[model samples]
Target: MVEDGHFWTETNWVFIEVETDEGVVGVGEANWTVFRARTVVQALEDMERFAVGLNPFDVETLRQRMYNGNHFLHTPGVVQSMVIGAIEMACWDIMGKVTGQPVYNLLGGKVNDRIRSYTYMHYKWMPPEPPEKAAEAARHYVDKGFTAVKLDPVRPKEGPRNPRIDELEYAEAAVAAVREEVGNEADILIGTHGQLYTHSARRLAARLEPYDPLWFEEPVPPENFGELREVVDSTSIPVSTGERLLTVHQMAQAVENGVRIIQPNVGLTGLLEARKMAGIAQAHYAQVAPWMYAGPIAGAASVHLCAAIPNYLLQESLEGWNGFHNDILEDGLEWDNGDLIPPEKPGLGVEFDRSVLESYAGEYRPESS
Candidate 1:
């Protein structure tokens, strides 16, 4: 696990390494939250008994054993989902390597040769005052060949509460500035981080509708689908959500409530379950845009999942997959223009540099025997 210094939260990236007796190894990443890396590690350790000595090829069986075996502890949430996802992901990786095919090939086959991606405008560049900074940041990525950029314009430190009118105005001005600068050259995605109440989100969406964003993401907290549907019915702009959703059942709830675009995080859902989620969305004529706020391993898993699913929308990118991401992965994810070229190599098509991963690795202390 490595400390994430990019955001304000005290988050750490937790990676899973599942090795086999034959020497093949697979990698996966768990979704990270403030001070939860060690907790996830503990969960993974607790799960080792169910995972070890299992056939890596039997992903579904393994998933069931890990998920159902826990009984009451198996309720869908961040920790359990993250733990199951990390192991399931590594199992797929091992399967791909054993078969000499990419994980996408194992899932089915690639429908997309290259996957389109969008990156967030850094929080520092998206100040509420002087909305021009938002435009400038949007332009920087647009110039770099990105066709879409996401921003959380109204990030009030405290909420589930409603934003004041002045705050709403700042958000409107920011989106308006971005639209003015980018014109029709690129799409704008508004990320609200579920900071607002239902009515507040609807109000904010009304103000932003004129700017024509590609999607309004998680305007309200994810707990209530009724409220989420309320925002969906209230907006002309497409409402996207599911980053916080842990299971396919929850995704189904969102889709049934009129969510057309679902954003499942492979880091939490795992590739097989995410593919299943995409399938569920596909039946409803909805699109799947895998979320990618975790580490590169999860990002790679998302890429493979997106490649195979026919209802693929687009995947989230972290600043074109540069900086520490490049340093840790063997060759890093291949980016040309704005699209990620699907890897032809076996497994997830990415490998971590041991030295770099070790440099960032935190000491894990197992419970007393």
Candidate 2:
């Protein structure tokens, strides 16, 4: 039961830089829980054999070998997927640098010039009151020109606290407050961190129908596709999931089961795999909204992806615009009236700052005994 805090914190992002022989460098990211950031760094170190001399343009060939070459890492999950994703990400970045074109252009150019973006606000972030501050936090982002916001007020039952009735009250009040404040001009996304029982979650979804939320995110855990399908069928609110789903097979199965929106993380699926998932989503009339908790590299990659995706709904970004990400790149990412503009610069359109990366080198991995 991962919460929004896992995506909000800045101390757990892993970055990868693949430098070309001609003095050009490309950047990528491996986004996961803080606890696994070190292991991802080590995985990247172990990948030097595969990545050292690979041609940046031969991304698919490299990805195939990376997946098939390793006997233990044939399937996609957190560890292997993050490692493969980071490698492919850097390859695309390097290609962009070599060709002098934005990654989006290489992916097939933009369907829309501006990609819509969204932000998440915990119910207790500002003003610290569960239901009362919901509207305030929503309004704060709205005032900043963001038109979409997400929050999860329901605590997972695993927490030893399962006040079902009270949880519904708090969740309802918070969403209602957000609706009242932002009105229909903005979209409200309801999150649950896959916490509630489908039967009860169905009833809760009905209760929230009045607020006209964009979707109910991960109402139940992501595993039970059959049960998740039932929940989606039972609810009027569009159901969304995919953060924990690792492979395209999982994503396609969920979408086929009727997930209205598919979220593929660049750090989890890599750009190419994520793009394939997006295409799968589009084939089913669904949309792709890349979820990110990694630093600006992931953010930049998502923006590039959104540019080329016809069914891109919106891009999720950290609310605070944490400097840990921005400080590492010269032209990280900028927001303009709730939309992201694709950069004209080539090769993922961002620079790597080795100084900031080295400062936290010790935290990247544990010392070998």
The TM-score of candidate 2 is: 0.91
Model 1 over residues 94-205: C-alpha lDDT tens digits? 9999999999999999999999999888633755558998899899889998999998889556669888898999989999999999999899999988889999999999
lDDT of 1: 0.86
Q: After superposition, which runs of candidate 2 have C-alpha atoms over 4 Å from their true positions?
A: 1-11, 123-128, 156-163, 320-322, 353-365
Off by over 4 Å in 1: 1-10, 365-369
lDDT of 2 by residue, 1-369 (tens): 124433336457777778888877777778774677666777778776887788788888888887878787687568778888887888888888888889999898878798788888752343226666778888878888888998876754472133468767877887888899899879998877777777877878988999998888887788889878988998788989988888888999999999989888877888888889988998999988788766788778888999998999988877644455566666657768888888888978877667876775555327551
Best by TM-score: 1
In order, candidate lDDTs are 0.86, 0.79
Best by lDDT: 1
TM-score for candidate 1: 0.95
The ten-residue window of minimal lDDT in model 2 covers 1-10
The collision pairs in model 2 are 96-347
